[model samples]
Target: MHKVIIKYVLIGVLAATALTSPVRAEAVVPLTVQQFFEVCQPTRVTDFVDDNDYIQFGLCMGVIVGLSSLMDLNCQLDRNDTPNHLKADLSGGNTSLTAYRQTMWNYSNDNPSLRSFPVGMLAASLAEEWPCIEPL
Candidate 1:
């Protein structure tokens, strides 16, 4: 009976050590917007086959508008960079375009409520504006 108890204790200890051992950390590679676009291209192509040109143009315009708004809002929210470091960088132009792309992608994926209404409005507005452009 004592031997059986000792065997179980040893097994538990081994199991605990194995479970707690540090995992090999994954290599972190920072992705660029182009790479992200490429990863998402197939889905975009399939989804917007008919409105590809309009969709692309709208995305570009939306990003520009969103970033401008973010800057304006940040300036009002944080006069000094001390409290909101990321907001300060975003407002100051230290954050790259890739950051904005990543943010949009994250918002679209993580929060449908944040996505749907704005996207619908943007699409409608862009589609209305599309025909006014003279072919280059």
Candidate 2:
């Protein structure tokens, strides 16, 4: 089944832009690769009183869903201001939250760096898929 996936055209996947500076400063690492990893790969606790893996997983996915909705809204405004782009496939087909979640899940497993930056790693995960190429 085809669904809408976030296709990120990270113009500056690594560089902090005018938009990300204030966000990075105000954020106590609101979204980071480390947090994603923790949420996606939470430790199983037998202690019923302390079990919160499901909660964290829900919250993490919720954020991504919210972001996806916002991206969709922005598209209506015809303003692709952010590095985020939405599509179905590598060529922008049917977008799905599972696709983005899976991409983040798979990407974090390999590069286990605790970079507490604003969605920089998120952009990186989709960079190879939707790169902002310049004609030579």
Candidate 3:
């Protein structure tokens, strides 16, 4: 049927466009600071945003919340040296998901040079805020 043929063609074009898009291509890996910031940070004022921004904001919150939840689960990277271990501490904090997203965005904005490294960027911001207690 012509309709079926058109549907397949449309799907193919969409797939090809996603594959060829630089942003989508790089998204296969963990989002780096630059990537995270670009996706998460709204370029326009809230009132001026188009419907597309809802998708962007939703995606941004999802990533931020996922990362925060991992931290809450006490994600740890232990180095041989006790003091070098990384962990999160969300005790007694009233911080919301939006706060976490903003904090991360700020960190990314402040450190453009570290944009390529996701974990490192996380370590510098989230981990540093509430690091693990070193054992004696």
Q: After superposition, how far is residue 64 of candidate 3 from its true place, in Å?
A: 0.5
Write candidate 3's Cα lDDT for 3-116 as tens digits.
999999999999998778665443322367777867776343465345445555666666776777666555444344423324565544787666676777788888888888
lDDT for model 2, on a 0 to 1 scale?
0.51
Predicted candidate 1 versus true structure: per-residue lDDT over 31-51, tens digit per residue: 333322333222333455444
Candidate numbers sorted by TM-score from highest down: 3, 2, 1
Against the true structure, whose TM-score is highest? 3
Reference-based lDDT, residue 90, model 2: 39
TM-score, candidate number 1: 0.32
Candidates in order have lDDT scores of 0.41, 0.51, 0.63
- Please write out the lDDT profile of model 2 over residues 40-89, one tens digit for every residue: 54333343243244445556667666545554444444444544443212
Q: Give the 10-residue window scoring lowest on summed lDDT in candidate 1.
A: 126-135
- Which has the higher TM-score value, candidate number 1 or candidate number 2? 2
Of candidates 3 and 1, the better by TM-score: 3
Predicted structure 2, TM vs. truth: 0.45
